[model samples]
Target: MPVTEPIRVGRDTKEELRRLKVHPRETYDDVIRRLIDVYRKCQQ
Candidate 1:
């Protein structure tokens, strides 16, 4: 398992992440990872 670190975000950013979820049970980690993968692909 990866070591987890806590980070802070504005309430608005948190709401945006919630809206970006594909499913209710998905974790923030999963959403962020998906976004990072998309960004890396675009950069390439």
Candidate 2:
């Protein structure tokens, strides 16, 4: 697996992410992948 650097999110966004249970152990890629799936479904 290609290791990517941590994603820097804005303070407001970081709080929302934490509320959503995305922690340091989770990669931004995981978040983006889920978003993409929902986006693709919406497009369809």
* The candidate that achieves the highest lDDT relative to the unseen native structure: 1
- TM-score of candidate 1 on Cα atoms, chains taken together: 0.89
lDDT of 1 at 40: 100
C-alpha lDDT of all candidate models, in order: 0.95, 0.73
Q: Candidate 2: lDDT of 44?
A: 97
RMSD of each: 1.1, 3.0
Q: Put down candidate 2 lDDT per residue, 1-44, tens digits, no spaces.
A: 79677777899986766565466777556767777888999999
Candidate 1 C-alpha lDDT tens digits along 2-40: 999998999999999999999999999889999999999
lDDT of 1 at 6: 95
